[model samples]
Target chain A: MPSLPPIRPEDVAVAEKTRPHGAFDPPSDAHDPVRAGYLMRLGDDALILGQRLSEWCGHAPSVEVDLSLANVALDLIGQATLLLNEAGDADTLAFKRDVLDFRNCWLVEQPNGDFARTMVRQLLFSTWQHMLYQRLTASRDEALAGIAAKAVKEVAYHRELAAEWVIRLGDGTEESTKRTLDGLAWCWRFVPELFEVDAEVEAAVSAGIAVDPRDFEAEYRAEITRALGEAGLPVPDDQRPILGGRRGHHSEHLGHLLAIMQYLPRTYPDAKW
Target chain B: MSDWPLWEVFVRSKGGLAHRHFGSVHAPDAEIALRHARDTYTRRMEGVSLWVVRSSDIVASDPDDAGQLFEPAADKVYRHPTFYEIPDEVKHI
Candidate 1:
């Protein structure tokens, strides 16, 4: 029943972005504040990853791949837009928020090192995302459930595409196999963070509006293992797990990414599309 | 290191409809070719079904030889469905 007020059209560019996080919070608000933050983080993960994938629009190795990547990016961006829309205007939430305020996983923010690396990242994320949305389709919150229903279908295709590529490159020639191995290794460290049950997520799960990401870990591991095995690769030895993306800490890459992503909005200020 | 074979794609928009050629995409093998077809051609829900055929396997008649191949059929009145007149009671025809 609780919803954030829509921003006035004139204030979208300035007042919304400049206002601090707590500035809009009402002390006696009825809903769980942490759950609201969880939704925002979920939206953030999609938005940031969407932005990362969009970087490959014209640069993928083949024209088919270029279109595939763009399609996937478009899907994630659509999810982000809707999820963010639940909180506030999607544009302000995406382009206006500072890096520290973003709540995406570090795995998504990593630069696309190569076609193999990008595919590996997609494989990892989509596999996890497919399961996440599948479970979230039953979320007690109807809005989240509806979004999950639509999102699971899209992520299913993304998972299939990425998994196939992982197998192709892993079973491919010497160079491609080497690249898949390296790409898998590069992405290995971020695996644990995808299921991190931080405070907001915990609260959301307790409220039944979110899935406890931990519940999907067993299947997540099995699916990734299966995809990697199909690719003829071994799982890397566990490294110290990276955390904190849920808490808004990110790698060096996201700031630079945002610098470009936010440039137009920051530069033009009130300029309308 | 070699590029995938070229495959022409066909899409059926609905049940009981004929598949029509949409476009071609290149993939390393048949399965990949089908996937590429799905990704490249059907992302918009444009098709209910898909078919992919290797460009090499299809023996397409040369367009330059069209007159020699089938041009004679164009003037064959007996081959036309409309060549026979139906009685007035045969309204559906």
Candidate 2:
């Protein structure tokens, strides 16, 4: 692996102020409507997964793993906040939307199972995000580009952490190895959803505001292949694209997730922390 | 399972300065150790650089040697830069 460059204080200070361009603007037709939806979907994916990961807060295998998972969750939440805050006020988008209106894929809404399953989800999602964000950093849309630039750094670390755990679990004991393989098998079908392109994405690509999901397939495949290889796992031969999130049709899991997540605020609508 | 080891943390605030000891946290290894240090110590943007060292690796002077080690140096007037006077002509001294 390449050495990480030294982080300069000036760079950190600069990044603190780096936010989406649309943060100050309400959704406007002049600003590429398709791109706006695409950005929202990206934000929704991060937000949903972050919420899912937060479930493991007090339940990880160890303190080290707990903190590590929490850190990744925080990063995803931060990205979600930036993207959603730009799309509209974050609170409204996160709390006010109907379940059918959400744009996150079904895979992200699935309940985090055991440690192996969570790691499987993390590995699958972060690998896709790593490729997606890398391309997004250079997007023509300045705000999305800025968000992607900062996010790539966070997601890169997430990928590394997930990849490390996959190796450890896959190669460790017989029981762990079996569980890791089962976890991968359980999640493999959802992998195609990450690459499912939609009309909104097509328009965004035409407008040069977003990269086509199809563009990332090769890179995403290579990353997963290498990681699985190192883990002594085989790639399952079955490949089928599962589509819905981009169309605003999510799994049943999302409703349950939202109910729990929004309960505190919904029950006590005027409560303040 | 083996207990996670504690690590001492140091953080560099910005350019042109050395890292100072920040605090410590428990982690399984150095990579996760640094990540833990970042999440715990620098979440509020207190640092630009992080360094994590195993707590066990740090060597310390014995409490009995404190008088001979540090107290003797306190009385050395020649070692104090305050004894030297800088002329007004010097700009950054």
lDDT of 2 by residue, A160-272 (tens): 88898888788778988898898888788888888877677788888898888787798788889899999998987765756788788878889999998888878888577
The list of candidate 1 runs beyond 4 A from truth reads A1-32, B83-93
Evaluated at residue B43, the lDDT of candidate 1 is: 86
The best candidate in terms of TM-score: 1
Q: lDDT value for candidate 1?
A: 0.86
- Give, for candidate 1 chain A, the lowest lDDT window spanning 10 residues: A23-32
Cα RMSD for predicted model 2: 7.9
Which regions of candidate 2 are displaced past 4 Å? A1-25, A30-33, A239-241, A270-273, B64-79, B85-93
| Native A-B contacts reproduced, model 1 | 0.71
Worst 10 residues of 2 chain B by lDDT: B84-93
